[model samples]
Structures are given as structure tokens and as C-alpha cells.
Target: MVVNNGIANDARVIKTAAALRRAGAEVTVLGIATAGGPREETTAGGVRYVRLPVFPRRGATAAYLRFALARRAAHLVRDPRRWQRTLPSLRWYQRAFTRELRALDPDIVHAHDIHLLDTVARTWPPHRCPFVIYDAHEYVADLAVAGRRTRREVESWAAKERDRISDADAVITVSPEIATRLAAEHHLPRRPTVVLNAPVRFDGPADPGAPAGPVRSLRAEVGVSASTPLAVYGGALSTARGLGTVIEALPLVPDLHLAIVAVPYPHPMSQELRELATSLGVADRTHLIEPVAAHEVPAFLASADIGVSAILGTAASYDMAMPNKLFEFLHAGLRIVTS
Candidate 1:
């Protein structure tokens, strides 16, 4: 399996890997290395994860230095080709992934998103290529981009997916709506399999020494008494999530406390939400918690009074999708309040 970002916080990827492992298949997930994380590690379940670094180095510091130098060189050269000059670091990672893929020589290749769809398709000739699975986590073609991507770039992604999607032996997506759209748009032979972004089922209490550690209740973690009314939202902090709406509405329900367990905390959006809460005189009732481990989420959120998915109609993708946090909340036994 291949993904563009670090795999630590991706619940979908983690769950998929675990399921495949339980089915007696060997899985190796190739993902981009994040700062201060290991380049390679094996999970407790024995699935191997290889994180391709942007530079050839064992230490994160050295890798960052080399990447910074490459970016500096790209600026100095000021090449007319925009991609070549602006994305030297990305190119390095791509080259590294390609090299790693060749070394693995697996029987099946799973491309996690459109970013690596073309790369995996072109890795080998059609006659001897592995059975490829393209997993679309979102409706990439019509995904909402907020100032981070140009229209041309978004179109290029759509084109890339359209071009290489036929090469995939099977396709998987997070929602039924996305699966139907993919088949219609790409003219696939069959609708892609719908795999809702659900949390892993728990048959019993997790072992104490588990990777996630003992389940820590949200109220305890946030230093709130058991009687405190807590509404929690867990996932990426973005405008698309309509978090600002939640913060703005806090004043209406003065007794209710909202906790946002956001990935990559101290994010710009989280800061903005905090400021908004303060302006509304509900700052004390708002809590910002760093994201918990993927396996630990349901347990961690079990004690919260409510789970909120205030997703805004910011884009077509957001409107047609089912957010995974909803399922996590269900598994945790929390009542849901969604938009």
C-alpha cells in the first residue's frame, strides 16, 4: 500500500492494513516520512511500514538539511518550469518511493490515492504488472482546495486519475456516493467497492500493554469532572469541517464544553477557532486536544457527552461524504450531533 502522507494519523489506512494482515497477506505500507519519526518500523501486528525520506539519510535532522539545501538551490536557479523549481522535495520523495517499490517487488500494489495512482500504474509493463488496487479516500477530482492548489493542478489530478484508473484491477472508496460517481465518470466495468470509514470493531477490552495504552477518557484527559457536559470533534482542523460554526454556537449553550481533538495541533485553524471562542466569551468552555492514536480514538472519546460532525457545505466532496468520526463516535457509545 502507498500513501502520500505520514500514516500515523490515517485511521482508514491503519484499519485497512490490519484487516489485510489478518487475512494472511503480508502488507508493507510505503508512506512519506514525517519529521522526528522512524523511516521504517514494524507494527505490533507484524505489518511493515517503510516511510520514504525526502533525502537519503538515517537522521531526521540531516534529511531536513539536505531538503532545505535542495529547495534553496531550486530558488537560486529560478527555472522557468514551475514544478521543477517549486517541488524539488516532492520529486525526491517520489524517486525514493519508486526505488522502494522496485525493491519490494510485491504480488499486489495498492495505491492509496490519486497522487500515486499514475506512479504505480507506470511502474511495470501491463503483461507482468501486479494486480493494482486504487483506493480513493475522497472525491479527488472535485475536492475543495482552499488557496493551496491552483485550478490547473486540480484538473491535472482529475486527468491523472481518469487516465490510470482503468489499470486498477479493483477500486475501493470511502463512501457509496463516491463509488457511484467514480464508476459513472470513469466508465468502469463495475462500481467500486464501498468501504465506509468505520472504526475497528472491539470484541472485548483491549490489552493493557496495547500500543494505544489503557483507554483514557476524554473528560479525564481534559481535566473535566464526569458531570461536565462535553461535546467532542476529532479529526483534521479545517474550514471544511465547519469548526468555526461550533465555536460560534458555544455561547448559545453556555454549559456545554466543546473539545476539538485535532491532528497537528497548534494549527492555524485551531488558533482561529480559539480566537473566535474568546471573542464569543466561551473560551473557557472550549478545549483543544491533540489527536489520539488511531487505535485509541473510540476508547478515548467514550466518555464525552456528545460527538459533533458540523461539516459545512464547503465543497461537493464534503456534502456527499460520510465522515469517519461519526462511526468512531458510534463505536464509543456517544450520541451524535451532525450537520
Candidate 2:
């Protein structure tokens, strides 16, 4: 089973799965299939892509209510707020994921995040011959740490994660900081594998194609003049992402157009960001837009002069994060400004 923790960054996972297949392994990706109803089947490269059944992700408010209702009484769970609404429900997904993994009966199972790490550590039966490998996408417990909540929450989650850490044949992480912390905390036998979050180095330059015209027209629709220096951020709009930094950066570069193409997250701050942008008197310059497909992201990023990626240092997860958008912006040839 080839598991990707999040839907916002599927292109990288898809590309990775394709390469794995070329090297001789049947791979199955677990997550949402598209923006519409969830579906599953083989991908272009013969790697199976399975979309788990999930609660519909409408917007910030609705998604929070849904998650809260679904998990009314939970201990030591991170704020569902940190996740993107488009992510398939983990609760509903676990069963289907297990069923398929067993059916596949692969030589190995590689998962993309701590959530999957926790899931497999607890459930993957001993009889199954699959040796598990986990990739730490982000340190989720750090979200609660930032809020100054009881470390009990983080500790509990970390303990479950340790269960995975002890058993996994291999552990890979996106950053050195994450690898260091996990190593220190768990008393790992040896250092975990560290893979920097970067696009695969292509052997040759990409063939030229025309830039997107419709997404470009979106700037005009929002009354953002074409001449204005466009500063943009994509992916889900969430609390921990520190979009306030994005908004605050707006006034610093006045006359700059800020395009926020936010996927609906189950965080209340998504709406608060809209209000904050409006109150900051930068509403006219700020274009709050809906999420776009992965293939279309380059076109949107291509039209921009700079990409804004700012997150507070308080959250360990945020501090350690190397989001796909950061790399995507670079791949799109945008300059990065971080705070």
C-alpha cells in the first residue's frame, strides 16, 4: 500500500508512485480522488488510487461541526482544524485501507504520515508479512503545543506514534528537525532516514506550454489590476498556517495583489481570515478564491510575482514544515519570502 497523508499534494505522491511502479512494485494511493465524489481505480501508471469515503467538506464552519459530531468524545486528538477538509475521513478510511492492504498482500507497506503510522502500528496484524515504513509529513502534536494546551494531548499522541516508531522497519521524515526530535524522544536504534521535501530533479527542461488564461482572469474579476505585483498562497487556509502573516505582508507591499486560493479547512480561522483581510483595509487587494486542481496550480502560480509562505514559530509542526506549496512555488519559478 502506498499511502499519502494529505490530498493537497497529490502530484508528488502520484509521481513517486509511478516511479515505484517502474522499479517493479504495485502501488495503491489512499486519499480523495478528486474535488467531487470519492472514487478509486488504477492510475495512469498502473498504480491503484483509492479514495476513501469521507464526510463532505463544504467550508470551515460546516466541516468543524461535522468532525466534532463524529468525534464527540476523544482524548488527546489534535485539533481537526489543522487538516484540510478535502482529506478523507480517517475513521471511515481505516477499514477500507486495511481490507485492501491485506488483499494486496504486498512485500511492504509505506505510509505518508504520523496518522497512518498510528493507524498501522495499532492494527496491521502480525500474520501479515508487510513490513511498515512511515514518513513523517509534519509533527501534528505541535499544533496543540502551540496553543499552550495540556501536553497530555501531545504526549498521548506521541506515545501512540512511538508504538509505530518501535515496530516500523524504516522511518523517513521531511526535515532534519523532525528526525532529530523523534530520534531523541524514541531512543531509535539508529537515525531515521531524512528526505528533503523537493521536486524530483528532471533530466531535461519541461516543454513550454501556454500559461492559464482563465485563472489569470480571476485576478481581473477580483478587481486586481494586471500591473499590480501579485503575491499569492494556495492550498488550504488554516489557523496554524499563519495566514495573518500573509495578510500583514500585504500592507508592506502596498499596491500588491494578494490572491489566497484556500481549500476549505475545518478551522474557524478560515472565515476569520476573510474578516481580518477586510478589516485590514486590504480586502480590495486580497482575492479570496476557492481551491484549484493540482494540475492547474502551476498556471496560477505562474501568473504571480512572489509566493508568500509565513507561519508562526510557536507550533513545532509549522516550524518543521516544508509544505509542497513551497516547492511548487519554486518549481513555478516564484521567489519565496518567509517570516
Q: Candidate 1, residues 1-339: lDDT per residue as tens digits?
A: 998887776778888887787679999998887654556755546578877664555455766777778867755643333543444554665676777887889899988887777677667777878899999988878777764664445555676677678989999998999999999999999999998889766443223346444356688778889888999999876787888888898888978999899887666686788789899999999999877667778888988999999987766778778877988999889999999
- CA shift of 71, model 1, Å: 10
Clashing pairs in 1: none
- Please write out the lDDT profile of model 2 over residues 170-227, one tens digit for every residue: 8888778888888888888777887765654433222124233324544554565668
Off by over 4 Å in 2: 2-12, 22-24, 32-45, 54-94, 121-127, 144-152, 200-226, 264-271, 290-292, 295-299
Cα deviation at 134, candidate 1, in Å, is: 0.3
Largest lDDT belongs to which candidate?
1
TM-score of 2: 0.73
Candidate achieving the largest TM-score: 1
Per-candidate TM-score against the hidden true structure: 0.85, 0.73
Model 1: weakest 10-residue lDDT segment is 202-211
Give the clash count for each candidate.
0, 0
